[model samples]
Target: MPDTPGDAHQSLRDLVYVQLRERIIEGEYPAGRRLVERELAETMNVSRVPVREAMQRLEQEGFLTVQARRGAVVAEFGPAEAEHFFAVRESLEALAAQLAAQHATPAGLKSLERILTRTRKAAEAGRLRETVSLNADFHRAIVELSGNPLLQDMMAPLDGRLRRLFRLTSGPESTSPMCTEHEQLLAAIRSRDPQAAADLARRHVAGTRAFALSALGS
Candidate 1:
């Protein structure tokens, strides 16, 4: 086992990757912003090697574009790609929700209920970022409750992209609508209605997709 939690080597890479990724998602880097390796190395207080490695990894992960002489730049979202990603995510998340509804334990449902309460409060308090994070946590907990490791693996990458998109679309007014959708999703899952749960999950992602598309001017 790795000394550090959550895949040590990958965690190191992810630490750098997440900071850079969040910067891009938060619009600090913006689209087509040039990434300077040495500058980032200095700012992050790490060697250029890790920065370069992180940049290459991010590029492979679709958050950046690597140019021969120009180095790396933040990747721009094209409308078609965004739509396609969301469509696939909707299908996968709906399946996950259905499985969760079928398999959720009493304890799992209770935990989900608690998460919903916290998420609702976060949204009400206008903590958009925290609400977005809790939203991901709520969905991840459902996926874990499904007891399907393969399904969890399939959803992880898409979840990362969704987080980025959420950050992109985040505003004061965005939280309430999302909170309402989450409430509906939890209601279906708590009822143990797989079809309803699946439908609600799909609708939630679809709504987010529409919101992100509009925000991206797609």
Candidate 2:
């Protein structure tokens, strides 16, 4: 069967979503900047339908907020929000690592190793954005390897926010250290030590929380 109009519209919406999300994450659309459907549609040379759809998705992901008088604006991610996010992240990720240590299959382990290899290369090449992105991928891969559908469901909403925070806190100096932490966590998981994996995952979250807090403060 031929592709339907709905399929084409959905594809455009996804493209617009990725582009807008990246712009917001990269600070191109700073917090409090209003997003107009018409303006963005003109800027991207696309129809308003896809732009509107993308903005709606972004708002749902916590990247944008809809105002009463105004339409949509970039949402502010303040220090207080970071604190709350990290507190949940610490517990959630610790459990994921523990479960992964217990249940990860050989194929899952190999997938994680591949992500780590790419992460190391990105960090070594001084690619801060790519490194941060891969770091999230590593954490997410572990969560999936945990063999827990509940955890994956819980993480879905926070995934975008986590990536935003990572971009906010990561720098050239921090990328290599984050890689080291992931390496240790992966080792614990590979060893099939639930306790060790949980501990290392907790510590990793602590380090990231500390850095995020410090970055937001300064």
lDDT of 2 by residue, 6-96 (tens): 8888888899999999899888888899999999999999999999989999988789999999989999888998998999999999999
Give lDDT: candidate 1, residue 112. 91
TM-score of each: 0.87, 0.92
lDDT of 2: 0.91
Query: Which candidate number has the best lDDT?
Result: 2
Minimum summed lDDT over a 10-residue window in model 2 is located at: 1-10
Please write out the lDDT profile of model 1 over residues 1-218, one tens digit for every residue: 56775476666666888899778767789878899999998998877776787888788778889778877898877566689888888888899899998999999999999998999998898888888888878888989888799999887766666667777766777788887888888888888899999999998888888877888783
